[model samples]
Target: MGLGIRALIMVFMTIFTLTSVANAAEGTATFYTPPYVPSSCYGYQNNGVMIAAASDAIWGNRAACGRSYRVRCTGATNQGVPQPCKGTSVVVKIVDYCPAGCQGTIDLSQEAFSAIANPDAGKIKIEYTQV
Candidate 1:
């Protein structure tokens, strides 16, 4: 390929990398167990291990099906103080859809959730990256 063409490709690659890095998102996380809300949405249930769900209002549960995300808890905050995070990251595959009033970046299965935060927290601030 010509030098000019090579340079153009390099520039495009750089732009793509930057754009993906920009997509790293922040949100809240929670988990559910057993018969997931809307149990019919299972993608790869793994007999109920390492499964996840996202809000139907955002990506529609099936859209994220088969995709996994690396989730890390940022902290807990009921008011405005951000506490120390659990510093754990776990990969969970999308396998179902959470029902109404489910406000979170992703809804993880009990196993996946416990891998990151103490489930007793109910909800926690989180940052996740698709890997």
Candidate 2:
């Protein structure tokens, strides 16, 4: 190949790799108010406010405990908060499980949720990746 074409191919390859690493799972999030103890994973130990509960989809049958995820608010899931995202992300440790009938992919503690979105949003669209 010509030198120019080879450079172009390399540039495309770099862009592709970068995009792959940046990809995150899209999901919904809801905030759970405290009394954040007696958790299924820790059992009454305080894991602090920057914690979340994984839904059944990500729970991995209790293996999710102690895992950390970086969650970013993508947008509002309901009309109640049309612009609820706070334009930031929060990292939270998995401290519990959000069992069956859970409304979101991850249930963030109220403090964690408010760090990335308006509390009034209640539930919001999110992009998350294990960190």
Candidate 3:
């Protein structure tokens, strides 16, 4: 192929690769459970909530948990003194996922949980928005 043609092809290929990678990272988030005792034992009701998961490498694993773009959990503990019963919203990145059929709500690092709601509530509904 001519030099110019080859250069154009390379550029197109690069763009296509980047587009595919971006699309693969995109995902949708939704509510999983409600606040209750035995915080770790709960089931998600489909269509309960909707959130966004931006272009990230975290979604590559089905059993990853950590700081994600956002996390919505119902059974959050309020942080600090004077705890209250309130929902929790956290911005976390997924480091690993829960085991298959594992009970409890989405796991999050203590740091992420403190960012949105208190840590004393111990169990509250949560809704997070992707940033």
Q: For candidate 1, list the clashing residue pairs, or say none.
A: none
Clash count, one per candidate: 0, 1, 28
Predicted structure 1, TM vs. truth = 0.69
Residue range with the least summed lDDT across 10 consecutive positions in model 3: 45-54
Best candidate according to TM-score: 2
Query: For every candidate structure, what is the RMSD over all alpha carbons to the true structure, in angstroms?
Result: 5.4, 3.5, 13.8
Q: Which ranges in model 1 have alpha carbons more than 4 Å from their true place? A: 1-22, 35-38, 43-48, 80-84
TM-score to true structure, per model: 0.69, 0.84, 0.34
Best by lDDT: 2
- How far out, in Å, is residue 120 in model 3? 2.0
Off by over 4 Å in 2: 1-22
> For residues 51-127, could you state the per-residue lDDT of candidate 1 as single tens digits?
67777644553677667788888888466644535677888777676677886778888878888887778788887
How well does candidate 3 match the true structure in TM-score terms? Answer: 0.34
Q: lDDT tens string, model 2, 35-105? A: 99989899999999999999997999999999999999999887655799999999999999998999999
Model 3, position 106: C-alpha lDDT score:
40
What is the alpha-carbon RMSD of candidate 3 to the true structure?
13.8
